[model samples]
Target: METIQFIHSGWAYIVLIVLVIATFNALIKFFGNKEFDAKDFRISLFTLITMHIQLLFGIILWFTKGYFDEMSVGEVMKNDAVRKLAVEHPATMLIAVALVTIGYSKHKKKLVSKPKFKVLAIFYTIALALVLYMIPWNQWF
Candidate 1:
């Protein structure tokens, strides 16, 4: 459980870096009217892959922590920190991942460079915002 937690925590850095890179890349390219090529595709794919890996580790950590077993929903909800960890964090992260997945899928369907970058820019930016918001700063530092 500790190992899983450690991995989840550590992998979050990778996810963040990749997500930032991907989001910025999309935004820059879209605004600059640059062509979407293999490098762009690879970056986006890598971002998706890293996020999914982190999500998997997070799910394992959540289950191993036994949050639900330890507290009733009401009890969990009543505590802000507990609520954040047990419910809000996971839920928000799940939505973020979904957004990234959707962005990747949508970008793939676009035949033009600008539209692909635009789709990726919008979705990845929103997802990155959520991820930044949900991360536990105190615990991490």
Candidate 2:
């Protein structure tokens, strides 16, 4: 369980860095009127992959903790920290990953560069925001 938690925490750095890079890349290219190329595709794909991997680790860690095994849903919910860790963070991250997935799929379906970048920028930005918000910054060390 500790190992899984450590892995999840460590992998979060990669997820965050790649997400930032991908989001900024899209935003810059979209506004700068640059063509989306292979590099752009690769970065977005990498971000998606990393995020999914992190999500997997997180889910594993969550189960390993077994919060519900010891406490009721209401008990978990009443405790702010526990609720944030067991519910809010995971749920938000799931939605963020879903957003990234949707954005990637939508971009691929677009025929033009601007639309692709636009889609990526919009979706990645929102996902990034949610990720940033839900992250347990106090426990990240």
Candidate 3:
């Protein structure tokens, strides 16, 4: 379980970096009116992979931390720190991963450059925002 935590924490850096790069790439290329190229495809795919891996680790870490054993919803909600780690972090991270997933797939199906960039920009940006907002920065850092 400690190993799980270690891996999750370490992997978070990669996830953050890749996601930022992908989002920025999408935005820059979209605004530049550049064609979505193979590099773009690879970056988006890599971001999706990185995020899903983090989400999997987070779920495992959450369960091992015994958050479900929390006696009641109110009890869990009442404690701000525990609540942030146990509930808010995972929930928001999950949403972020889902958004990245959707963005990757949606962009893939688009035939043209602008729509591809638009899809990736929209969802990946939202995912990045959610991730940045929800990470347990106090504890993790």
Candidate 4:
């Protein structure tokens, strides 16, 4: 459990950095009317892979948490700390991940360069905001 937690925590940094890079790259390229080239594709793919890795680690961490045999759902939710970790954090993060996934796929479907960047920029920016919001600040670093 500790190992899983540590992995999740440590992997989050890579996820964050890659996400930031991907989001900014998209936004800048979109505004500059630059072509979506190999570098852009690679960065977005890297961010997706990093986040998915963290997601897997987090799921393992959650399973090891013993939420199944312990307190009632209502009881868990009533406690602010528990609710944030067990419910809010995961829920919000999942949404953020979905946003990134959507952005990646949507951009791929766009035949035009500027539209592809626009799709990436909007989706990634939204996802980045959600991820940043969901991070457990005090417990995390």
- Compose the digit string of candidate 3's lDDT tens values, residues 11-99: 99899899999999999999999988999999999999999888889888988989758557788899887788888888888899999
Q: Provide the overall lDDT of each model, using Cα atoms, as 2-decimal numbers.
A: 0.96, 0.96, 0.91, 0.90
Write candidate 2's Cα lDDT for 1-141 as tens digits.
989998999999999999999999999999999988999999999999999899899889999999999999999999999999999999999999999999999999999999999999999999999999999999996
What digit string (tens of lDDT, one per residue) describes model 1 on residues 3-61? 99889999999999999999999999999999999999999999999999998999999
lDDT of 4 at 83: 88
The collision pairs in model 1 are none
- Pairs that collide in candidate 4 are none
Better of 2 and 4 by lDDT: 2
Model 4, C-alpha of 21: deviation from truth (Å): 0.4
lDDT of 4 by residue, 37-124 (tens): 8998999889888887888888788889976458899899899999899989999999988888889999889998899999999999
TM-score for each model:
0.99, 0.99, 0.96, 0.97
The TM-score measured for candidate 4 stands at 0.97
Tell me the lDDT of model 3 at 46: 95
Candidate RMSDs in order: 0.6, 0.5, 1.0, 0.8
- Model 2: runs farther than 4 Å from truth? none
